[model samples]
Target: MGITREIGAHYVQEKGTTFTFWAPDAEQAEVVLHVNSKQTIPLQREAFGYWVGLAEDAKPGTRYTFKLDNDKEFPDPASQSQPDGVHEASEVISHTYNWTDQNWKNLPLEEYIIYELHVGTFSEEGTFEGIINKLPELKDLGITAIELMPIAQFPGERNWGYDGVYPFAAQNSYGGPEGLKKLVDACHKAGIAVVLDVVYNHLGPEGNYTSSFGPYFTEKYNTPWGAALNFDDAHSDHVRNFFIQNALMWLRDFKIDALRLDAVHAILDTGAKHFLQELQEHVNHLEQQLHKPFYLIAESDLNDVRLINPIENGGYGLAAQWMDDYHHAIHTVTTGETDGYYSDFGKPEHLVKTLKHSFIYNGMYSEYRKRTIGTDATANPAKQFVVCSQNHDQVGNRMLGERLTKLVSFEMLKPIAALVILSPYTPMLFMGEEYGEENPFQFFVSHSDKDLVEAVRKGRKEEFASFAWQGEAPDPQSEETFNNSKLQHSYTESEKQNQLRKFYKELIQLRKSVLKKLCKEQLEATLNEEETVLQFTHTSAGLRCVINFSDQPQTITGTQGWQLVLNSADTKWGGPGSDNYTSGVITLQPESVLVLQAKA
Candidate 1:
């Protein structure tokens, strides 16, 4: 029997409750229910090292733990709710919910305009309920999806969610499992899909006792977090099933529309059937059963096309993957910061390559890695690449967690927004980027262990040495650091920020109404190295965007029959408002972008 049926705590009022666990290493396993009275129930060992038992009194809200080998007690590895904490008992949760999203068919991949946000910092409440109140705002902004930073249970009240230990349980601080369901249901009603970011590379350090129950992780390979999961090692089927079921739980039970797999490059697997391929197959089956679109998007830096290719084409059949080239190219060009990976990107030609080929280093020699990198991805549709101007990793990993808004000239922000939103790919906006939220998204954690806290602080400082950033690094353990990371929501009161907000809304409106229907072949770009200008034109859509990256104004010849649609230099958008054009020639202000359309 598969571990899927026998794992976790399943409750049926009439049939009592069924509790199961995978404990091959133990001679005995017992379910210790914590209720009015502690009742110890022994589980009968089944095939494939799975143990199963029936408890007459166990029901929804029943707190319990597992006693392995009839000795040490540990929280359920398949816990549905850790209402107490990671180190405490797990509570049985009912899947029954008054879901009103029965007709909520997911949007297609090309139509996805994802807004990535950390729920803990998105609002002052920092709970799932808090995010629900803000869904209509995102929907009004033309956001089709809200990609949340992980919600899996981790230690304490603060984390980026990458350190989640219990993949099955929603964080208690975030209102637990029930709260997440309410949020998902609310999102559907608001016409916004939810994309969860899940970390499968490695579990967190604290309260991670999966190894005590079974060989969940292998020492054969080392990940940045720690040891890689035992995906291709001995008893790998159980380990793989553990995570696959977790994915299913979120999709089937929580009704999540999509999952953004974090750091697939770190998930080392050498088996003939890669874990991703198998996962895709399972998700495909689920999609067919549910009659809804289910997507698996990966965050990979290896530039491997196989990760997103169809299984029939000898690939994993993922829907899309995060493409960082566009961000790196634009960041480097706007900031002129040639350090680390940005050293390979920054040129006008590089940005042009990113626009044309979907990758800047497609089979080219990378100066930073000192090696030829990336496979050809020109055959893939633009929608297969998800581009963003800013994301958590690009911002929070910095020495000061400074956003592009802090680094680039104010005039440069609009152009960056235009390129990302109008590009022939799915575009994502980091939380608070729409209105230029000035809050720094620094790396902060809430670990209880003093020694572990100190180690994390030291490690964070050392990690920035490679970036060569100047100034003192903020302490990750400091409360001030975490407090400063919260969203201000003060952009409404500022004239410049409000204009930026309006600028983003208009671009998104244009993207959905005009750009999505434009033919990919009609897109073309011309880069002027000498003038530091870029002209991107969409012939079918009768749209042309010309940007000036230089510190001084530059003249560019516009195509015949073109008229101004939007101007980055327009005074309405807080610029010098340069809108005058001499028939076929236009002078763009320093670090400004202008959009023009052919007169119908």
Candidate 2:
């Protein structure tokens, strides 16, 4: 194997441009080309596991794959883009599209109403082009930004994109590089920003050939998946650059507005200057150069506000982070699943704590960890945290991959969605969550090695049992599992889906209208731990939403001329029709949420 480059940004004048991969451990390595017909162009080894080649003709729009150890092919270990599905050939693409959002600035973290979805599972087509077709639908639903699950190339055609072998490559199956660009451009044109979920904690099991050429991973730390990245080990500069470069590449190459980094809690680095801090610095620079707003959303189990604190304040300076505690608190209360991490979240006091402060475990004892978990919230701003009721991880981690849609009845569902979207913090929706699709997001793997696939299946089943689940696990290798996960487009036409869609549309619009004013203010939520009643008072565009999350009919005094503007129990939300609460004090039914218009 032969190669030489430290993220070498090169340009070839003759055959377009070319990138090389070196596999010294293998007998052969070939560049599978999508130009001049699909063919494998031979790669020549040079110095130290380095491979070299030239295909100046391999410019943007050209797709190619890498063949290693003779017949075993893989997405390029260094592939920066993928437009096709994950298992297909890599493609050379150009970010040469026109962007009309020259004056479009980020709407601030507090105002964001996010919808989290998997590109493959979002629609029946389950591809980048597929999501593009539904931009209008998302826009109509009033989502400011759509957060797509990981798109990086993994072992199979379908899996949670977290097991990415090529951290840089887009999944070839989801419409490779060019296809992704089209989708992003379409999103921008429709005024909807796209935020991609990325995995930086650890690489997937198969096709992970990074360590062969460089010090990409280390045995010093271990993640649930496998070896940890060499973030703080010797020769760490190269490793750090590899990941930092990847983060930048997605922003610049894909025109992605934001990145949702998966499992940041799993990332390891003990240096004085954390890699996350360094990454944030680079993103800030890119933001300035692009003259456009950009963001970083972190997923962390640790509730330490330290992750979002400014560098000067000893923080990572992330724009926002997923508040898993919020989910734990709500889900535990409703489902009463007291196993695993839910054990610490069962008490009603946990729900009240989170509702009041956005994080219940902030600098408190955690029975699950058997220690004091989380540091104090920055008190700086709650907007730095993103709260959600459901997401890919929570749904897919289950044995049956059942969403709250199937677990909780419609009666109790609307209020939870309302609490999340209308709260003081930003909100994210899992794919198929709006319409309540019932398809299970089963675990699927497609390893080329038969033995490895068997091992994965066995391990997956054992893990599910730990969570007290039982059933015949889906064979990830089967095409049926992937097909089943695809979002059924027919649901959008059904009355329930359409009704839920409209209700969400109204919710997002209401939040935006408020964002035009209350950008950084904290509206206190007074929650009653016993009754499960929460009253929130926030000033928004000459209105105030005093919501009730209780289960019994109750009335409270209202401000003069205050009228009801929206209700979760409305006909539009597929809830039972209720009497008007448009004037004075009104009685609210069980499991209902209400928004009121206050007299100025």
| TM-scores, all models, native as reference | 0.98, 0.87
Cα-based lDDT at residue 249, candidate 1: 89
Residue 301 displacement in candidate 1 (angstroms): 0.5
The residue-by-residue lDDT of candidate 2 on 488-567, one tens digit each, is 75555798877876777777787777544442244545555445566665654555554454557766664457667788
lDDT of 1 by residue, 1-600 (tens): 223444789888677789888878789999999988888999999877898999988889899999988788899988989988889999988898999999998888888899999988998999999999888778878999999999999998989998899999989999888899999999989888899999888899888979888989899998787788999988888988988999988999999999999999998999899999888888998999999989999999989899999899999999999998888988888888888778888788877777778887888899899999899887888889999999999999999999988998788899999989998889999999998889899998889899999999889888876677999888877788889999997777999998888889999998988787643467898887594999888888878888888889988774567888888888888887785776788888998888888888
Question: Which parts of model 2 are misplaced by more than 4 Å?
Answer: 1-9, 12-76, 81-107, 490-493, 515-521, 528-530, 540-551, 557-561, 580-585
What candidate 1 gets wrong by more than 4 Å, as runs, is 1-6, 518-520, 529-531
Model 1, CA-based lDDT: 0.88
